[model samples]
Target: MTAYVGKRLAQAVLVLWAAYTLSFVLLSALPGDSVHNRIANPEAQISPEEAKVMLAYYGLDRPLAEQYLHALGGVFRGEFGYSLSSGDSVGHLITSALPSTLQLTGLGLVFGVLFAGVVAVLINYGRWRWLRSLVTAVPSLFASVPTFVVGIVALQYLSFRLRLIPSVDDGTVRALIAPAATLGLVVAAPLAQVLATSMRATRRQPFVHVLQAKGAGEGYIFRQDVLRNSSLPVLTLLGLAVGELIAGSVVTESVYARAGIGQLTVSAVNTQDLPVVQGVVLLSTAAYVVVNLVVDLVYPLVDPRILVEGRSRRSARWRTDGQAVESAADLPAGSARRLPAEVAMP
Candidate 1:
């Protein structure tokens, strides 16, 4: 267990390191510096000398290697630097926007999982192959509909046309419903598809057949035996869904005019705010790593066979001397050193 945990932590560190390095490299590769965007405005008519000064001020004149090293050093020293466009600390901006993003991600995941599970159960209960195909087809079709389209359509129908919620600037939980539902539906689609497939596969497992033969009800076998065994693949899919949620929210945030990290990221990129962009990239990467790590840890618990195998292998290794040690429970009852009655007789 210690070894497994240590290995996962090490992998997480490496993932974050790679994220930072890649963000730095990509930001460096974008043509032109931040200063150019400001001085290049034809209406502003800023002189060449002023542009040069602005460039130097922002350290654009420094070698790329030095700039990257300086930025990295700042990160290590707990200074994320300021956005070139907004004149705000990148860290501060991220902190302010993080709550909204986390809220969106969390809500979307919880509802998505529940919706998928319910849909899978209903589909299985129906037990009609044609109905299953039609139900399964909904998720695939919904998955194909881009998140942006969903957000827009939800805004149009639910918020505007139906007046189910306020359309603009309501700034209430009620206002969040349309966007969150849209995002959740998009997430639920893939999850439902995966769940349906996994549940069907679990139903065909030999143990499920054994359970059914033993007079277990379909619900009992499915809920007590099959679902637990089949959940690992569902977890892996959920982790991927988390990554998709973050990636897909960029468009969703824009459509909904939400003040989440996705919106911040779009603004940062549009204005060439390298510091803010890098910060957002790092934040998203950390989120992905944490989500995947959680899924990996949950694997052992959902599938106890992993730990059982480990213990079995360890016990085998411990008994390498070839001397059989009889467990006390294996001793004959009523002997001087008789085993406990439960194990010895029963």
Candidate 2:
């Protein structure tokens, strides 16, 4: 387990480093930067000498290699300098905006999970075959539509026509409904697709048929046998969904005009506020890495086949002979193994 955790941690760190480096390289390659833009603004009237000093202070006057190294070191020390457009510390700008984005993400995830759960359940257990077929098609429809369109349509109908939710953010729960639901729909599409596929596959396994033949109730079999077996892949999907959530937030925040990291990101990028932009990218990359790392660590706990002894399921002998096929090394010495019930359908 420790070794598995260490490996995942290393991979997370590598991903963060790669994302930071790639973003910096790409942003540096851009035609001009915030300093240049600001200097060109006649309204600010920043003199040539002042401009030179500003460039040097921000390390823009240095070679790209030196600047990259300095910025990388600064990130290591939690130093992101200042935002060119706002003239505030980049950290302060992000910190101020972080809470709103976090709230949006939490609410969006909740709504998304609920949507996916309902869809998955209906696909698996709906009374009418046509209803299940219709439910299955919903995910593809969701996946085909862009998130912003959903937000716009929801805004038009829910806020404009029906007045069910406030169109603008007033720092109230009523203000959050449309945007959260839009983001949730985007999240639900892929999650529901994957979950429904897994659940249906699990339904066809031999053990499920065995349970049914033994007169197990449908509700009991579905709850105890089917749900647990199909949950592992969905847990993995949730980790990957963090990326989608962050990406979707940019459009969602813009549509709803919410003050958040997403809005901050949009402003920073538009003005070419490199420091703030890089800070946001780095923060987002770190978040993505951390969530995936946590998921990797949790996988062993959720699925016994993922042996914490660093053995892959492919390596383990899978004996479904009503016996515990897991290694004795994974258990306390001399401990009696408790074999779990085998219930799958063919």
Candidate 3:
């Protein structure tokens, strides 16, 4: 078990290193220097010497390879670079924006799970076949609508037109609803579909049929067999849905003008803020990788078969403290055989 975890942890480190390297390469390829763009305002008339000093201050004056090595080393040492655009540490910027995005995704996932689970369970009840089909169709509509469009529509109708909530602020939680709901809808749709299909499949399995024939109550079968068997697929879909939630909310955040990581990413890209862009991209990618790793680790807990498989490949050893006894009566003086005399006697 320890060896398996060590291997997975090593693999996770390699994956994160590769992702960070990839982010650096992609950001490096973007046109223009980070400091150049920031100080290029015609009205400001920034001099060449000042620009050079700013570039040097952010390490942009160094070769790309050197800068990358430094950045990678800094990451390992718990240091993030200074932002060329904001003159603030990249770490600080990410820390400031991290909470809102976490709150949004976390709450959105909760709502999505509850919505999906309840709808799926109720819909799959055989008595409501027509209603089940109709409810199942709700996910299709959600899948069809783009997240950005949902954000716009939500803000327009729910916030602006209906006056249900206020329209713009970075400080309060009220500003989170429109964007979170927009993203939640997309996540809920597929989760519901997957859960409903899994539940139906579980209901048809032989164990469930056997339980039904043996006079077991529907609730008993559902609790003991159906839901248990259905959880693997549902959990797998949840991981994928979480990825979709993050990706979808990028646009939703922009549309709602929220100061989350997504909005920060967009601003970083538009202005070609390399440090800020790399910082945000690395932070978001780290989040994605961590979420996936957590999901991977959780799968075995949900299914003991996985734990068995993980252990079966390894060699097991046992130690004994005393000489072997040939017969129950002939056993060593201090050791008593637990087996019956008829069985242990030779």
Candidate 4:
């Protein structure tokens, strides 16, 4: 387990580095420097020498390789550098915006998992065929809909038409409902699909049959056996869903006009703020890596067989050797008894 954790941590560092490198390359390839983006108005133009000085100030005049090395070093030192557009520390901007994104992500993940689990249970365990089919199809329907579309629909119906929630940003929990639900439903769709499929497969396993033969109720069997067995794959899918959640947040935040990493991302992209963009990408990659690391750590606990099966195999090998030795010793005197293959081999 310790070795596994260390390996995962090492891999996570590599992932973060890769994300930084890729973002740096892509952002650097874009036409025009931060100076042009910052100085948007042609009417308020500066001299060519002044533009050169500005580019030099931001170290943009350096070779790409040098800039990349500097950026890599800065990341390791927890210095994300200054935002080209705002002249504020990229780290500071990210920190300021992180809380809202975290809140939305947490809430959306919780709600999505709950919603998916409920829908999966109803669809799989319920008796009505029509209802089951309908519920099963709902996830596919939701999955087909984009997050932006869902957000807009929710805003129109829930906020504007029904007036159930605030029409615009109020920075209140009530204001979070539409955006959270939009993100949650998008996350929930694939989760529900995978979970329902896993549950169906688990139900067909021999243990489930044994439980039924023991006169266990369906609910008890499902709760104790089916759900637990089915959860491993679902947990894996949930870990993978973190990326989807982050991607969806961009659209949801834009629609809701919420202040978050998503909104910060949009602003950075529009202004070609390379440092801020790199910072956000690095942060997002870290979040994904951490979440998957947690899932890896939790996996053995959920399925003890993962840990025990290796030990059992080693013990079985030892027992086989002992049995071969015993069989060799018990050979009849002068009876020409052939030794077992295992004992004769060595």
User: Order of all candidates by lDDT, from best down to worst?
Assistant: 2, 4, 1, 3
- What residue runs in model 3 are displaced by over 4 Å at the alpha carbon? 38-43, 170-174, 313-346
lDDT of 4 by residue, 269-313 (tens): 888788888899999899999999899889889997765654443
lDDT of each: 0.79, 0.87, 0.76, 0.84
Q: Return the TM-score for each candidate structure.
A: 0.84, 0.88, 0.84, 0.87
Tens-place lDDT per residue, model 2, 198-248, is 999999999999999999998999899898898889889899899999999
Worst 10 residues of 2 by lDDT: 337-346
TM-score (C-alpha) between model 3 and the true structure: 0.84
**lDDT (C-alpha) at residue 111 in model 3:** 75
Model 3 C-alpha RMSD vs. true structure (Å) is 8.8
* Candidate 2 residue 37 C-alpha distance from true site, Å: 1.9
lDDT of 1 by residue, 1-346 (tens): 7777788999999998899999899888888656777788888789999888877777778899998898888888878888888677888999998888777777777778888887887677667888876776777777788888888888898877898877763578887766777778767887887787788888998888888888999878877977887788789988788778898677767887888898998988888888898888888888889999998888898886776666554453211134333554444455344223333322
